[model samples]
Target: ATTSIAPTTAVATTSPVFVPVTEPPSATPPPTTDAAVAPAPATTIVAVDVPASTAPPIVVPASTAVPTTTLPPPPPAPVTQLGVVQDVAASGPLTVPVVDYGLPRVALGDSVMLGAAEELLARGFAVDAVKSRQMISFLPDMQIIRDGGSFGPVVVIHLGTNGPFSESTLNSMMALVVDVPIVVVLTGRGDREWIGRNNSKLRALPEFYPNVTVLDWEVVASQCPGRCFYEDGIHLTQSGQDFYASQISQLLGMG
Candidate 1:
């Protein structure tokens, strides 16, 4: 019985077997497995496009300019005839009559007398001239006019060149000729001593008589040109005759 039981046990009875199961070290499971993803990269935003605006241009007004003009000067005024006559009167009146008494051959008084005669004829007046050898020789003639009292307003006595006369004689003659203007023309051509003496006598006459007039021959000579006199330096030429006539006519206002 013992043998039979041992065989059966070896054959059918399995000994107590230990199965070893490895559970992957109790499933720690890769520490619950959360994946470590990289954090997302930061994003930057920028403005892409912008618009520009335009402005209008400014305008200015123009200025107005003015033009300048120039004017011409006026013409001079004309001289009147009355004014010319007044000027002539201011120098000496042309209304007075003239009587010339001078020697012709000795002192060229004939040429002067002829010129004066023509001038008086043009001025509507009668003229006469007497030529004496000397002024003293004409005393009788002057005395005749004085006695008759027919002499005019003016008597031109041109003398005292050939010879010298005393101041007393000249004064006496002047005194004898009364009631008229006596213009004593001093001698032009003569020595300086005679001229000085005649001038002295003339100056004395103004003190004695107011009616006595003294005309300067030197002044008349200054107005004469070279053609007015002859080459002899004493007498007047034809041109001188015409010039004297013109001067006398102008003084008388004949033209």
Candidate 2:
């Protein structure tokens, strides 16, 4: 019992302790640089540069620089004279003569006279056809004989075919001429039947003028049956024209 009590009085020994680790702050990385703050890429940009000392020039065409030229006008036409003659006494009968004066070789009045003159020339008659406006107002006198030459005994007058003359004017014209037989070829009426009928009425002047002889153109027109006129219906066709000229030639004893 005494040995067991001594064994319980033995002393206890202490164990070693572990320490905690603490590291110094790591070195801070330098402030990070942004990629957007990098330099711009290289490229060339062209620009026009003008000087302040000079002004811009103006241009013009060659046609506007030259001048144009012009020419002058022409001359006017000439004037003339006209008349009639007659013979009231002869062994057979009385007769009249017509003498025309104006521009030589041209027919009197208008185209109808021209065609008549052409017909006369074809029939061996020495026709002095005058181109004249004065034929309408021509007075009968010896002055035309002095100017041109003497006309013979029988004078056949083919006139007023262009238009009708006033009664007083026609009478005055008749009064101007002396003693001669006057064969007044009546004007042909146009294609209208009414005109021909009217012409017969108007042709009563021979009763007043005793020395005048009236040749009926209506009768002449009737000879062709139905077609006596040119396309104009005023002028005569070749056949009509020839027949008319022949009738005149027979009346004047030129046939």
Candidate 3:
């Protein structure tokens, strides 16, 4: 018995061990060849909150617009009347009408006119003057000229130098040539007392006839003092005759 107990020993059996296997997930999807056959993307909708007091936005067109303008009114027309000359601009040549008086100037006087006769005749005057002749005795000559139809459109008379005539005699002389277009009467210049009285009558002629004009030779000759006349103070010197003729020519519209 003692020998069998010392040699008894049991043997154990070994079992196999099991471990779990795990692989990391792939970083990207696998490559595909049928890419065109994928489904289309769906519409996305986002929601936002808005206040009640906010206004809607305005849209503008691409084209631009033009502005308008205002104009002013024109001026008034020009005034027209007779004897009023208005300057007119002509596009072409213009014709002007000429007036024909149909008569020359006829002048009758005493020695003072005789002194200026040469100067006056050269200025287109028909002059007839007499020395030491009175106005009272000159009616027959005026009648002869009027009857002979030789009296012109303009008549000039310078008398009352040799002697004074009555106003009745002056009226008789004026009656012959009163129908003439123009009649110019002259006052005599001298120291004679009758000269003043005769000039007063001569100045009165314009009151009765509208075509009469008085040329006061007395006032004109007095401007030169002692230089205008000779020692007699009735006849004119050379300067005085020139002045006298110039005055007559201006009155007749010749100067």
CA RMSD, predictions in order: 24.9, 23.6, 21.9
In order of appearance, the predictions have TM-scores of 0.48, 0.45, 0.60
Candidate 2 clashes between residue pairs 3 or more apart in a chain or in different chains: 86-180, 87-180, 95-181, 96-155, 96-181
Per-residue accuracy of model 1 over 30-111 as CA lDDT, tens digit each: 5644888688998888877766546666667687677767777875432211111212324553343344542211111333
Segments of candidate 3 deviating more than 4 angstroms: 1-103, 224-226
The best candidate by TM-score is 3
CA displacement after TM-score superposition, residue 114 of candidate 1 (Å): 6.0
- Cα deviation at 184, candidate 1, in Å, is 5.2
The candidate 1 region of ten consecutive residues with least summed lDDT is 78-87
Best by lDDT: 3
Error of 2 at 49 (Å): 99
Question: lDDT score, residue 168, model 3?
Answer: 90
lDDT score at residue 77, model 2, on the 0-100 scale: 24
Candidates 1 and 2 compared: the better one by lDDT is: 1
- Sorted on lDDT, highest at the top, how do the candidates line up? 3, 1, 2
Q: What is the C-alpha local distance difference test score of candidate 2? A: 0.48
